[model samples]
Target: MTKLYCLPHAGGTPAGYRTWIKALAPEIEVVPLQHPRPSDDEPLSLQEAAESVVEQCETDEDFAFFGHSLGAVIAFEAVRALSGPPRRLFVCGSAVPPVEASRGRDLRSLPDREFLQEVARLGGLPPEIHADAELRQEFLPGLRADYTLAETYEYHEGPPIPCPVSAFRGLSDGHVDKDGLRRWGEFTTADVTAREVPGDHFPLRTSATFLHRAIRKDLAA
Candidate 1:
């Protein structure tokens, strides 16, 4: 793919894609999608975020997509809303976007320290920062907002995206296994391929080379 749009994990900013961009072949251009935090001026639902992205995506480019964690689902929804589908769509570290209610601890509503501690346990925060009582406090709001976004997300009923789909996962991530990743095939009529890379959930955030490799395989196909 000549142009790829990248989306980030929960609590992630566009800067998270830098290493992923560099790790890719020099011929490919990376465009990171900057999802603004929900504001009173522009409160974003999943569809709203998708709409925002669709408006920015020009019809002429041979665009492909790669999104991790919450970004994966957002990208999925966004592709469905696009007038022209991308060449390929890659999703990692998530299940097929959840439409119904999910069962879990209500992390968003938990007390700050308790919530931060829980996110740490789930590998959301660095252990050192989670341990540093004062330092962890600084990350609370963004982290909470991200988790709340994830927890409350509901898929809209729509026609599936037409692009080829590829799913990737950290080998040991307890959040979603390889099978869950495979289920993404249900959302697309075109080819859906799944693979396992060596790492946990958070590594995909810092380790872009591996993610680049996974995405390149699809481009080569």
Candidate 2:
């Protein structure tokens, strides 16, 4: 059986990918990375986070990567960090090569109310949760760390990996555009395929069945 390692978006949990396993082909096993919450009481650099994900992979098997948002960046970096090639790489709901954001906005440093307001503006957050003080307090610190990790990532250009690159973006996603999404081709010598799914920034959760079929075709090809 081939393992498909799935990475989650910011503030995301394993439950998102766990849902996909039911839709995935039985031969393709789904392995969701264990993302650290901010409350883990330990801070990890972006590279360390990638390494943590890599350290968990089982050896002696064919495997591939499927990451969304922050997970996408980690999976991409982790693949480059490894000695062997994965069967394929699929980055969903993120820029292909990943563009850099402006330095020093520091969303993580804002006060709880202000920081959450910023998170809300980005979408993916529900209004009801925003209104709940207890829930907001619990979700804020961890989510802020995720946003900081992603925003602070410095993308250093190196030789592309040895597997095919398939990028899946959200048609309505405001975070990334098609040209940026298509740039993933430049990272790999293998043929790259870029296409849009139906939602924004989280199609992996919203469109798991569609993604399962798409992943199945990619693996079969």
Candidate 3:
């Protein structure tokens, strides 16, 4: 059976991909990866998170990576650092490498009020989490850390990997468009395909079954 490593979005845990284990079983084994929270003095960075994933991975196995949003960028960086590249890469609901902030403002630097506004526009985040002050306080730090990692990333130029890239986007996601999706082609020497899945920014949640079916098709191909 093939191994499929699933990475979650920022402020997300490995549990987010728990359903995938059973869904893609028999033919594929799903391994969900999560980032460790750093100490207060040690801020998070893209490289740190990626390196952590690389350490946790079983590099000897035949594996592929599936990541959403911030997880996509982390997966990409990890792939670049890996001694053996994955058989395939699935990047969902994210822009091409060297991801920029939604607007000119740095999301990590924005005030809580303004930063959340930008986040709300992106969707995926539950509204109730923001409505409750205690929850907001608990969640914002990790969310900001994720934003910092993504927003501060600088893509170093390198040869495209040999594996195929299957870029999945949400039909209603305003952040990424067809052009952004197509741009993923530049990072792969092998075939790169763009697919429009259901829902807005969080298709993995809104259309789990459909997304898994699509992934199964790609894996089969």
Give the count of colliding residue pairs in each prediction.
Answer: 0, 0, 0
Q: Rank the candidates by TM-score, best first.
A: 3, 2, 1
Which of the two candidates, 1 or 2, achieves a greater TM-score against the reference? 2
Estimate every model's Cα lDDT from 0 to 1: 0.75, 0.78, 0.82
At residue 65, candidate 3 shows an lDDT of 92
**Model 1 spans > 4 angstroms off:** 39-42, 99-105, 127-135, 205-207
Candidate 3: residue 163 Cα off by (Å): 0.9
Which whole-number lDDT from 0 to 100 does residue 57 have in model 3? 88
Instruction: Supply candidate 1's per-residue lDDT for 210.
Output: 67
TM-score of each: 0.88, 0.90, 0.91
Residue 177 displacement (Å), model 1: 0.8
lDDT (10s digit) by residue, model 3, range 158-179: 8887788899888999878978
Candidate 1 lDDT, tens digit per residue, 1-221? 57888888877777777765777758677888865445445555766776777776665888888888878887887898887889899888888886312644578888887887677778677555667877666666666666766776766667777989988888878778888988888889798999888778865754557667767767877
Prediction 3 TM-score vs. true: 0.91
RMSD of each: 2.4, 2.2, 2.0
Relative to the true structure, candidate 1 reaches a TM of 0.88
